[model samples]
Target: MEEKKSKFPKWLKISLIVIFVVGLFIGWKAYQTFMGASVTDKEEYLYINSGDSYEQVFAKIKSLDIVKHPNLFDYAAKAMDYKDIKPGRYKLTPGMNNRRLIGNLRGGYQEAVKFRFENIRLKESFAGLLGKNFEADSTAFSAILNSEEIAKQYGFTKDNFFSMFIPNTYEIYWNTSPDKMMARFHDEYTKFWNAERTEKAKALDMTTQQVSILASIVKGEALHVDEMPAIAGLYINRLRKGMLLQADPTVIFANNDFEIRRVLNRHLTIDNPYNTYRYKGLPPGPIMMPSIAAIDAVLNYQHHNYIYMCAKDDFSGYHAFATNVAEHQVNARKFQKALTDRNIMK
Candidate 1:
């Protein structure tokens, strides 16, 4: 090595030094481009909508203000041949480098969103909720919900279409379509009404829809889950005895005035079919979307001689049950007195 150095010219030594410097610079640049901190925050999200172009997706990423070196990201993305940007909700976590972020986008590794609905009282409200969660708008969802022809394809009428949806939290992509959402609900409804549940409904002499209808009433009556079965039994007894359901929730629904804290004698006179006090049988449909617990309560209703239920006067969200008119009237009077004392006259 000493002999070679002796033979080497000064220019050659300078050239070698220059080459080493250039190589080091190139290596550093490559490292920065490939493994640098791209996501500047602990977490970020990117929503690429349907039919979004690559430029549009890049714009959305820029708008998030999470990218530390957007130019490097652009160069890396182009070099990796990432032309197609999949539409979905993408979550970018901390310590993600440029290469990792690009890989996630190129591979369409999106995060699923939680979609949940319970105690939804109106089809319109349910539609709005679904629209907010997915790409479909409220009008689009409402159209499908109101269409008898479309509902019939799933073995449901427009009036009873709500029965097809079971209340639960579902993990789904944010871009799910309305039609797909409806199909999913139908599949879930079919799976929920399995042999065991169906057999139980049969024993009760009720159809799946009938169970849902009664479940809605039970849910409206009972604020406490423990009382659901008792409320279901009371309603069942009333149904069997050819008595009016006399459910105040149904009366409130019929009036379309949820603000009426006290269901007065005037509210019961509403001519809407949802008023159980006026209607002989179950309402034209469920006044509200019933939960799985409420539905099961109807299927496994407690056997008892109690044919009446009045909300407890203590306002403890419990009810008092009675076997006859005298006891029921006494319970009703106590509750009425409590309401009057509170000056909740409506």
Candidate 2:
């Protein structure tokens, strides 16, 4: 069989060769447009706000001065058809290509923030912490938290509404709405209180809210993890015996002064529901966002005869426990003398 003959016209052959070369060049350019390294070698994050237009996102990318990519993403976006950019905090790696970067945005594959809180004593502080880790600011969160309607929506009153947020590390998106954020916390709180935990709360004849309140006190008094159960037990004993809680932390909380190291007589005289020194039962709410360990400590409090706690005289975080007024007075005297020697007078 004879091979096919070339076209007779020389000009036609030359034109065909030129077209083939141009097509190859175009293909190579397209490949580099999508796959070549375009972003700058910098550790930064790109924040895409909700409801942002494509133009706004493009402008935001440019504002970062990001890329070897001054004008390339337009072509990349068109070629890859990456419209509807998802809102989030997207991490820009050291050196990323347009395809990898835009693909992540298109799929809404944003980094989940590690949200957490500890020793959070007020709604203001909690809101502030959320503001730091989310697209929503403190004001937005505070508005939601301060709303009595929102609190009721979560099955809590405004006064005790803060108990819905449990302290733990949570994985959440940065752009979650304020209401959704509350829902998420509520979900976590519910999951944390399982059947076993509910049974334990019933066994002790205490509500979960009451447990959280006592946990906050236990957390306030005990500096070391080992002492949590003992302190919890002492408080439980007081509650069972109908004695005044007289917790120094509650006195500090009633004064709304976290700076008070020594609970003076004047401080205890504050007229507040949170003042366990004046009130005969548990405080109306938790004085702080208690830790999980603290909560569990109350659930599994050590059974004992102790009903009093006085901090040790050595400026150590540890405390001395006593079962009687006389013993407590002796411990209190030693701690008071140590405080006086150290000039910690109120």
Candidate 3:
């Protein structure tokens, strides 16, 4: 049998090669699609804040509905070999791929909530603001404020905590710890105490506590910021002589009740260290949170011989500053009439 010489068509062989290449391409495309689907299915907004663990982070992502499979995030995170990732609040987006989301989570991408500080009574308010979103106890915070142990780091004793806080709107992380938040406040107060402020306090023979005490009085007595400086100067002038700083706010602080719309003669007789109407100098400590304006007013207090001030209902929102008691009484009587007529002097 003669072996027939095989005649192969060149186009047919080329066609087979083309089919193999196309098949390979299709398989690779299908694999890519599967991988993509594993990542891009969920939309979420989440915050991986400080002190969050891997499990906690996974839970948050799941809550955001960004990742359908928490186990996949866990596996990917571990495979990436990240331990103790720096955590921050993050705004997760819809259909974010898993790898990219993991990268963001590990990079400490955070979404910050604006937590503003308001009328706080020393450290308790700080704790309340921060603790509202985190673990914070007001009583424990007050203990730290009054504790010499933690305050030593700021170069002051516990006795100075109340004076150190100046009421202002502060921006802080929603999850900031109580201690860290307090430190931030300490820094703010320290920055406010410039050389000029210190020199001014010294010139007035007032310590930081004394200034804060005066500011608190100004805060309580004056209903508006426009009247703070005048009241501050009134107290300062009284201090220059041997007169008592007879501020009504001190009595309220002593009583622990802002009730008693009027501080009567009997209220002054009650013995309390904070009763400035009875004592000869500033109160032992601040009675309330003082705004920065009040603090500034005391530091740069106006120089005057005015020993008394009474709210003058001239509709100008100002008090009549007087050098003598007789003029003060006349103004006081006029104010008394306004209060009685308005039924404000209950």
Candidate 4:
């Protein structure tokens, strides 16, 4: 063996030793880049906008100042051929290594936003909320929502297109398109109106939209969930008798004056289709995005002869119901006096 080793030159031996040391150093660095924690303390987010170049993505990552050893990340990114940056809202957790971070960016593994909306009364307001939660702008969303042709495609008119949006929390991607979002809503609305719910609506001699309309009135009438069924029943009784729904909330909605504390005689004269006091049946659409509880209340409304409701005089968020005009007048007088005492004269 000594004789064989003698054939090796000193330079060759030195070269081998140097190469071994360099290899060890390179291996250690690679391990640190791929396995060691790179993200700083606390969670962070990286928003790679659409059409962003790799350089732009790197700039954003650097601007966040969350990554430790950014050069190492760059090296590893290049080594893994992660040259393409996908657009998304990526969540970077603490203790995330460069490999995992790059993997997320390359794969476009975005975080879903918890988009929620309820009690949205106007189409513009609903569009604004959707814009805030998604990539679509308010203008674009509103235009699409107001398009008669688009509404007809979904089996709705522009005025009633808002009924398709069942108010609830939705896990939505940040970059969902407007049309895609509407389609999802359509699917959700269909799923919500199942065979059982459809049969219930038919039993009550109401369409799905009609039920939603009544639910909206009930929602606007009372804030207390426990009283929703009673309110719904009162409206149903009124509907059955061919009497005016006379829902005060509908008058307020028709006047477009949400600030009105009292629906005075002046507000009632407004010629709007939403005015249930004037219109013989349900409005063209829901006055507001009715809650699921309100919708269910309409479906399971308590059978009663009550055709009238007035806000209670005690300031509790409950209503006084009556079957006769005389009893309703007494309840209304009490409420009017309370309103007068508070100086809520308009």
Candidate 5:
């Protein structure tokens, strides 16, 4: 026999030994690298949207070359317990290996920034806020607010811009246009209107426009939520009595700022239609976007004969309510004294 061929050929035996050793090394490395290191290729950009199934997401990762293999990425994502990722634009970088990449992508790395609109005075401010994200024309926004045609179609005259809107925190997508955002805000207001509020307005012999006007005034006056209904009641009483609302906020609104050291009898005579002190009733429109609390105060106002209120010098945001001219004058004097002491006089 030819030296009895050893049970195994030399090359075959050598190959088997090499294969086992290689397998052992790979196994140890795999065990050591749980959710292993990221790949070191060029960075890739990916836009993942919600509603993508895991397989679909895997395909996107592969197409972007953000991962070396779809199957591996999917397996790692599953192993890492990745699920239900929100869809959004993601900046994928090199070194985002199967494990690291899946973790970051599935962990929701997208950032969100909030743009708040509170106590904003004019339509221009709103347009300006929107301009920070998207190219917006403040002039156009103002024009839209003052557009007789748009206002007429929407049942809101140009004068009613502020009153027609309700102030609230709105989460808008980044980079939204001023015009489109304003339209959306109007839609939100429309959704808030109910038949009960409508009927209440009708019963009070008030139009939505008038109610919003009063609500805006109530918002400007009542720094505290509890005071809104009482303040609203005062305005309502004044309206029922055919007395001028005589609201200083209206004058300040007309003046385009609240810094008027004193509402001299002259300031109240501003020719603008927003001059409620000069007008016989509510202003032509809202002075600010009334909060829901203000709107509710108008709708479910407490029944009262009081027609005046002054801030309680405590700055607790409460007010002093008065039922007669004498009492009102007393409260007003007290508020004036408080103002003098604080040197808030302009």
Candidate 6:
């Protein structure tokens, strides 16, 4: 015979079990509602405009859909007193809880925007690029960039100030002022022109600005990096001979038209000082932003007697060097024929 078992009330046992299950469900829901993952798993970003209020920031956040539970986020924000909004680019990641997200927005913990610019041709275009990347408007950037007084304040002329910004990967704040941006550019420019580089420019009897100008032309002409030194050397030879640069790229720049693929005889007749065919020296300024390789090529140009260059007959993008104009003409005919066959006529 089994020992007699004491029986509890069925209603009481069922009540206890119900209470235990309800307690666990409540605890889990509270944890998730308060401190669980609020941000989404997908890679998303939120850009807060300057002068945005907390409500405006919230609106933008909701628009981005980076948060999983907006109601939970709102409660967390209220509890944490996250009322202040800091303007910047916020890189949202997965596994970010409400506290972390709110703290990131409130404390201005922003990710630096990595801006790697292309070989820009105009300041207007550059300003637009900055506008797209930063919190500032394009008009604001353009106003300061084009201002002569501002340029002079930074020890640069209006014409040559464009060279201050080296085309490279720059990590900068999204809310940087135009003045501060220029200051940073100047600082970078100073750092780039180290003692050795300055001495190299001095030995070449050229200022850094002049070197940049020439580098821009070299960048314009040479499609391949390896060809830069030779093209630079050829330009130096032309300069020594007091011959006009006659660079087709410069002619294209002079016409204020970047669409001209083939530099025609008519394009060379432009009276602008930037037209190297009409002008005897480097243009009033750079035709475009020069690459570091092109600038270094100018500083360390090859020593050669070759004075002329033409693109190779094929699609190699390499130029054929010639010590004499006749040889240059022969190479030019080959390239021209190739161009004609390819229907690149402008």
What lDDT does each candidate get?
0.88, 0.89, 0.72, 0.87, 0.73, 0.86
TM-score of each: 0.94, 0.91, 0.76, 0.90, 0.66, 0.89
User: Judged by TM-score relative to the true structure, which candidate is superior, 3 or 5?
Assistant: 3
Model 4, 1-346: lDDT tens per residue? 4556567899999999999999999898888999888988644677767788988877777777868877888888898899877887788898899999888888889998888889888899988988777777899899998999999999888877888899888988877889988999999999999999999999999888888888988899888999999989888888888998888888999998899997788888889988977888888888888889999999999999898888899999888889899999999999999999999998
Best by TM-score: 1
> What is the C-alpha lDDT profile of model 1 across 37-78, one tens digit per residue?
778783467778989999987886677766777788888889
How much RMSD separates candidate 6 from the native structure?
3.2
Which residue pairs in candidate 6 collide? none
Q: Compared with the true structure, what per-residue lDDT tens digits does model 6 show for residues 1-346? A: 9987658778989999999999999887777766787788655677888898988877766777778877778777898898777888888888788788888888999999888986898899999999898888899999987888987887777777787778889999998877788788889899998999889989888888888999999999999899899999999999989999888888888898899877789898879989988889888778888889999999999999998888898878898999998999999999999889999998
Stretches of candidate 3 above 4 Å error? 1-52, 64-87, 92-97, 111-115, 121-123, 133-139, 152-159, 169-176, 314-317
Off by over 4 Å in 5: 1-116, 134-143, 175-183
Candidate achieving the largest lDDT: 2
Off by over 4 Å in 4: 1-25, 41-43
Superposed on all Cα atoms, model 3 deviates from the true structure by an RMSD in Å of 5.7
> What ranges in model 2 sit over 4 Å off?
1-28
Worst 10 residues of 3 by lDDT: 31-40
lDDT of 3 by residue, 153-198 (tens): 7766665567777666666654566788779879888888888888
lDDT computed for candidate 4: 0.87
Order of all candidates by TM-score, from best down to worst?
1, 2, 4, 6, 3, 5
In candidate 1, what residue range of length 10 has the lowest lDDT sum? 1-10
The order of the candidates by lDDT, greatest first, is 2, 1, 4, 6, 5, 3
Instruction: Provide C-alpha RMSD values for all models, in order.
Output: 2.3, 3.8, 5.7, 3.4, 7.7, 3.2
